[model samples]
Target: MMAQPLLCEVLIDPERAKGLSLQQWDLLIRQARHADLLARLAYLLEGQSGVPTAAQRHLDSAWTFAQRQAQSVRYEVASIQKALSDLGIPVVLLKGAAYIMAGLPAAPGRLLSDIDILVPKPCLERVENGLLLYGWRTTHHDEYDQTYYRQWMHEIPPMKHGVRGTVIDVHHAILPPTARLKPDSSKMLVAAVALAAEPGVCVFSPVDMVLHSATHLFHEGELEHGLRDLVDLDALLRHFGDQSGFWEQLVERAVALDLVRPLYYALRYTAQMVATPIPPFVVKALDKLGRPSALISSLMDCLFARALRPSHVSCDSQWTALARWMLYIRSHYLRMPFHLLFPHLIRKAVKKRQGSGSLTEPIVVKE
Candidate 1:
């Protein structure tokens, strides 16, 4: 058996898996699955020779499942595009859907649970009504929940297709309306590029896509999938960084969008953890935009390094839990002011205790 490779190393350099024992392979597969990265591992190892038969079988199975899911998601997206076509709404895909629709390298072997689309805020109501008419209904029917989303949330309450059971998140903005930093949605819409293959389907410009991904990852409360999200950032940078002038454009756009902080953290951590190659000039430019203090930087490094690792039993530690909680609190703090956050947290806690609120809360409708 060869020496056991670290998770990051195995991802970056699949040849490192050459001589692993069956037990080691098992552990790696389990860890990758737990991190929502099994399909990515499959993609990396598919063409490599000398993989153990058992590991090969696991990889094949994972790849097949991922491909099936990706197809379904694409079909759902097409149907959605058709449904909203008559409204003349320019449907801008976000996150997983965006990567897949744009045919980015990050698309293959990706798993998607919900389809996210952004429309202009002015047409949000019309879009919702159109979706409802097409058999997509809100999942939540509670009055307070409906009010909460309309008043403060970035997206409407998630809707599900009546017949297909597909979930969709319709957004008019990237961040919550109440967030301290609001990127100009209209500007993002203006810069969106139309998909050549799919009429009415569009995606963010490369720079804005990276900014939005960074913002989503850093501002999210959930850390269980932090590792997966980081991997996405790494993949995105590698794919888009190959273009000439990409780095300069990315930095300028981040400044224009007030998203330099998230870009800084994304570049910093991807460089540290995944050995992502970042240009020195880009680093210097971002540093001039305001780098964190040494103490704060050190603290965040500790927290993120731990939280962004695979969240399997073998990886668990007291420090990991503490770091995740701290980051969770930090995410909420970044999302809203204390005056709003306190009550929001309290309401969430109450809902959780009552077993009424889950990560995917159903939309509430009133009579």
Candidate 2:
């Protein structure tokens, strides 16, 4: 544990680049790309002491894409704001979109797949209808798919803009009702902070923001972007760590939100992977609510240590694929109760078999 991965070492001290040979830089670049962190590393190393010209070109290209993505997110947010304005629904931005709008340190070079927003459950119909009017159409056409989403999920099926091809995930809650932990959506909605710079756009309060990000990553099935997400957690922690009572508030909110488990996972991995600074007392406070048993903790360490590394070939051992598959199954197990889960998994397997080589290919499973 004394030595970190090269990518983590470089992130912790960008000045370390002065010592890395071209071959090392090549491996690092590949690692970052597979982790979905090439751009974030680029942002971190921009003016650091020694970056080779060849590597700079690749980093620069990623930076350009990140810049365009930020601007595009802004335009799309504005369009969404306008679309919901008349209905008086508050659009609570989440994750990447929230980071960008709020000018969080995490925003820079943050690559985003889609915009996510939260509205009250009562407003779901109105919000969907309004978005439809703005050329956003429900993309899931299957009857079972629609029922699966509506009957037992956190958010509805994703909506894609007919014209722009951008996707949005609209949520009324964080965790699905079927999920083991259910945080009160109403409290988050009430506590949301409005972005004065961008009217009509609200984001989770600082503590809520941190908790949600933790919950999103640790509770999810997929881990291909695991390291990128761990980086996001590191960034948010570093940015917010200095605020008065920030750590205390984080611990308190995690308890209040039934999110201590995710918070523990977040704190542990961010610190382990990227050296994210978290107060010892804050970690200690969650011993009862968050910490797993010693045996379980050791097992998770084995899984996450492999799963959270870059998915690049260089990072894998004989067990890497199995580690990720185990975590994927673990996430789905935590997502819903057994009565619904067993049947759902069987149905999905059957559908996958039935849809092979057809236009109605089975959905790529995700949280």
Candidate 3:
């Protein structure tokens, strides 16, 4: 069967298009044309002047007013970083902020709507309280919603600053309770390096950062409309290369955290889309995690169906299914004792059936 025609225009910039192979060009254009992705696309296209007319038109069509909104977000991010420093909480700005601070040339033009900062788990309350004092407050919700954010979620309630109106996502962990897998944030903190020339500010080690990005996409099940995120995984892999023990370390880390399945999805999608270099040893390590069975595949399909493989783009139901299974299998492996699993499952089902009600309701004895 013939493949669907790619929407991005042909590359006209000789220099910009120079080192890229045909497949790389295809990935770039496809990523650039992603819906809700004009900011990131504009950032990637900044240095190249001779973009194809067709691609330029496609980009123009995708651009939105959010570009201006991102500017305010950027300024507020800088201020928040300074504030975090003042409170003696070492902050590592993740994703959107890190990309900007790196001076990647692929920065600036991209739209950034939020500020993500990481603090040690022990310092989580202190950091949240500090941000509050600096005028960042939680969303208005009932006690249940607050409890959900403070207890179950990896991050605190999304805090909005009074003056800036900018949202800050303060993370103490990378995954949510629903993810069923957890990485050691403490270990990540220890391996982190201070942001270049930015004292008291730090970011994850390159491998951890990349893995975290992949996990964010995989666990969030947000790939169906994820052409830009695919580009992110590609860029990180290409930038990091295979010279480092990245793949092996990633496998080991995933196993330690019981996150092997997400790692599998990450490697598979990255390889399929960007042809990322995966060393032989890394492939060998994946063997231990085993491949997903048919049952696992169907489960992943349900999870990522709405998140990653939206029909408007590509119908990657097969890929989504496979990813979902891997995720579920990993979740099963990550579970504690059999006894704990059943009770947890029952509680979750009951909570889910409560239908948007907060989990704060207390159970009472029958009269």
Candidate 4:
């Protein structure tokens, strides 16, 4: 009988028979080799034996840039944190960037594109204004977009410094379009502990951070390098492995927040990817969500396609069809009240054309 193929083999990209001379490309392949990320690394590097070259190149550059940008961002973020501190706006860094910035050894060399920070809603304008004073400018500024952000979304616009060229995403809430789930950003914030050295900036409580990363993966339909996200899940679980009550609290919080679905998907994927030991009770709770195994398998095939990079969407029609349907479902869930959902959606469609769309505009931010 044939043995099962290694997970690494099933996950990695096939090797390139040619064009290995590019230093950046060679370095990536070599690092992936050392890091055991080779399959996905090679998959990303080789351009069309059937895949698109430009997309391959773009993703490659992003990967390389992410490594180079890491050291610089730590200092830059520290400076920004100081500036926010002066203004009394508390800032919390999110995800991989947060992990790296906290001086965690294994994290520094990994790829990260942006720094995510969360500030209180009341201080949203102050944070933006503070960053602007420091020579960071908002990239996607339109009155309509501003109105949408100010009135509806969970955060203000993303800011990019002209000189540094690194983008900082400032968020006030973890999940937007509030009706879809109730994982409270406030609870997350309250649980946030200060990074030991980077005292000014905070990180999500381990469970919240892991949950957020998982939600981002599953919610986006796991469309990018599936391996990269799997790596993130692995890292988070490994980091938080010894924490007592981590799993139990995660489920209780998800149940209270109505975000059990993504939590289930996250646990299932993590269990599959890294063999994390989820309790049988947790497994049974997930099973009650009704054949998630089959549902996610179907969703993976129909609702998603892994493009190495964002611009790889060569066909507008195909991209739009998938995006539109996803947005429709997302918006429908965002509207908890079915009776008002359609009219709200129509209003949103009009506002979107007028460039005033946002997921949480109608819900007021309470102190």
Ranking by TM-score: 2, 1, 3, 4
- Kindly report the root-mean-square deviation of model 3 from the true structure over all alpha carbons: 8.7
Question: Which of 2 and 3 is ahead in lDDT?
Answer: 2
| Candidate 3 clashing pairs, residues 3+ apart or interchain | 223-308, 224-308, 224-309, 296-325, 300-324
> Cα RMSD for candidate 4?
8.9
Candidate 1 ranges with C-alpha deviation above 4 Å: 1-5, 356-367
Better TM-score candidate (3, 4) = 3
Candidate 2's residue-wise lDDT over 271-350, tens digit each? Answer: 88888988889878877678999999999989999888888888888898999989988888888988889999899889
- Candidate 3 lDDT, tens digit per residue, 73-96? 456656776667776666877876
How close is each model in CA RMSD to the real structure? 4.0, 3.3, 8.7, 8.9
What TM-score does candidate 2 get on C-alpha atoms? 0.94
> Cα miss at 261, model 2 (Å)?
0.8
TM-score of each: 0.94, 0.94, 0.70, 0.67
In candidate 2, how many Å is residue 224 off?
Answer: 0.8
Model 4, residue 160: distance off in Å is 1.1
Write model 1 residue lDDT over 1-367, tens digit each, in one string: 1122266778878888888888889889888888888888999887888888988888888788888778877888888887888988688999988988888888877876788999999999989988898889999899989998999888999999998888899999988877777788889988999999789889999988999999989888898887778788988999999999999999999888888888999999788767788999999999889488989988998898888878876676678899999999999999889998899899988988898656554433211
lDDT order of candidates, best first?
Answer: 2, 1, 3, 4
lDDT of candidate 4 over 285-342, digit per residue (tens)? 7668524467655664344332211212221234535654673455455534566456
